[model samples]
Target: MKNLVILGAGTAGTMMANHLVSKLPKKDWKIHIVDQFKTHYYQPGFLFLPFDIYTEEQVKKVGKKFIPKGVNYIQQRIEKIDAENNLVDLENGTLSYDILIIATGSKIAPDEVEGMMSEEWKKSIFDFYTYEGALALRNKLRDWQGGKLVVHITEMPIKCPVAPLEFAFLADSYFKKKKIRDKVEITYVTPLSGAFTKEFCSKSLGYLLEEKNIKLVTDFAIERVDFENNKIIDYIDKEVGYDLLVTVPTNMGDEVIERSCLGDDLNFVPTHPNTLQSLENENIFVIGDATNVPASKAGSVAHFQAETLTDNILLYIDNKPLKEEFDGHANCFIETGNNKALLIDFNYKQEPVTGTFPFSGIGPLKLLKESIFNHWGKLAFRWIYWNMLLKGISIPFVSRNMSLKGKNINN
Candidate 1:
């Protein structure tokens, strides 16, 4: 039987496994998925954990629970990928495959930043990208008595690019609810010149930061963290002081990609932007945070890519050309605060525009605008993620390719 191996059981790998298992014939092929961890984290929920919006139980479930029955799930650490031999080296044994899918995903490398992993880490310096970091920050914020709370991003292409901004907005709301808004000074620091990658979204989000009284410090590339002084120093020696530093550190792909020489400077595998095929090896496919595609590394992007990637994999097996292409379609819900959220939908060609989604002129969700219904939709996504997304069920009206039918092109 032909063997199909998928690395990592995260969002991309799990969805791809489910998609392929249903499509690929059982009599001809066998699917196997490998992951190191047992628990699959609802990473988006990590943003709400510090704010006590989601409990630990709400964000975690067994990795195997989502993996389909037809697929063999192996839980083990990956040693390296022998691409030349079409084999994978695991800590326990070796596995061979006719086709391979690398979806190991990216991780925050706090240690890569100078002094970021110092004594202050989890004490004064905290991150919300991980479960432990979120829980630790929750404890710190429990009695934080009004001081400089700096929400910083170390670098770009981090998973859920909007999460840090959401954290900043939610923190503003959280302190206001606690009657400490006037006492707490919030600052958002990023390497980018604006609030976000796209100019339209940046301008819109920047206004929100100003309106909320959260200071915006852009174009500040961090050089080091001065834990002793509770400061973050940029390349030019300009420092931002903070009593509590909530940071998103340098994110890198799995080390196995690096060891196999299959990745770029940041360890992200170089991939064809439209095809989702590894540039180095066509037989290998990559999705989610693993690829060096100039797209937001959010769950929505992965969900969209899975649709096209699954189709391409089938084509490759049949010696057929990949017909489907991913347009970097990404839709994100920006939780602005106080029961209001903003939704932005865009693709590789289009920056987020002001309009409605799924239908023109009329929508339950509006783009680049805040509303209570959008907030409810954001909360409802958790249910969709568990019940529908992981099961590889196609979302109606949302295509793999981005549609401009509802977008206001003039904007």
Candidate 2:
């Protein structure tokens, strides 16, 4: 039987396995998925963890529960990939494959920033990217009486760019609910020149930051965390002191990519923008946060890519031309707290614009504007993610390719 090996059973790899296994003839192909961890985290849930919106039970599940019966699930740590030999080296043994998919996701390296790993890490400074970190931050925020709370992003191209901003907004709400809004001060620091990377969305979200009284310090490149002084020092020596620091540290692809010698300087797999196939190796493919695709490393991107990628994988097996079409489509809801949120939709060529989503004139969801419906959409997504997304079932009103039908192009 022809073997197809998939690495990392995160959102991308999990969905890919489900898509391909259902379509490929079971008599001819054998699918094997490998990952070190057994628990599957609804990673997006991590964003809400710090705010007490989701508990540990809501987000954690067994990876084996999601894998279809026809697929082989191997729990092993990947040591490296011998891409040249079409083999994956595990801690225990090496597995060979005819075709390989790299869906190994990205990770945050707090140590990449000096002083970030110091004693004050989970106490005065914290990260919400991981479950443990998020839970720690939640506890830290609970007893935080009052002080300058800085929400900083050390670098860009990080997973879920909007998450830091959401944290800032949520922190504001959390403080107000605790009767400490007047006692605490909130500031958002980023390397980017605006609240968001996209121009139109930046304008909208920047206004939100201003409206919420969250001070914005743009274009500040963080150099180190001065835990002794409770300050974050930037490259230009600009300093922001804080009693509590919530940071989005430098994010990079998995270490196995570096060991495998298949990734770029940032350890991200080089991928063609339209095709979703690994540029370095023809027999290999990459999806999700693992690929440098210039798309948001969000679940929505993976959901869209899985559809197109599944078709291309089939084409490759049949000696047919790959359907070179992934438009970098991504949609995400920005939680602004107070039972309100904003939705944005865009592709590689277009920035987010103001309008309705899915349907131009008749959308239950509006883009680039904060509304209660959008908040419900954000909350309802958790259900969809667990039931439909991970199950490889496609949702209506969304497509594999980005659609400009409902978006206002003029901005």
- Alpha-carbon deviation at 271 in model 2, angstroms: 0.8
lDDT of 1 by residue, 1-411 (tens): 999999999999999999999899899999999999999998999999999999999999998999999999999999999999999999999999999999999999999889999998999999999999999999889889889999999999899988999999999999999999999999999999998878888876678988999999999999999999999999999899999999999999999999999999899999999999999887899999999999999988999999999999999999999964899999899899998999999888899988898788888789989999899989999998998888898888888788897888896
Cα misplacement distance, residue 246 of candidate 2 (Å):
0.4
Q: Compose the digit string of candidate 2's lDDT tens values, residues 1-411.
A: 989999999999999999998888989999999999989999889988887889889989988899988999999999999988989999999999999999999999999999998998898889999989999987877777998999999897899999999989988888889888999889999999998878778876677887789999999999999999999998899999888999999999999999988888889999987888899889999999999999999999999999999999999999999998999999999999998999999889989989998898788799988999999999999999989998899989898887888888986
Per model, state how many residue pairs clash.
Answer: 0, 0
Error of 2 at 77 (Å): 0.5
> Distance (Å) between predicted and true CA of 221, model 1?
0.7
Off by over 4 Å in 1: none
Write down the lDDT of every candidate, Cα atoms only. 0.93, 0.91
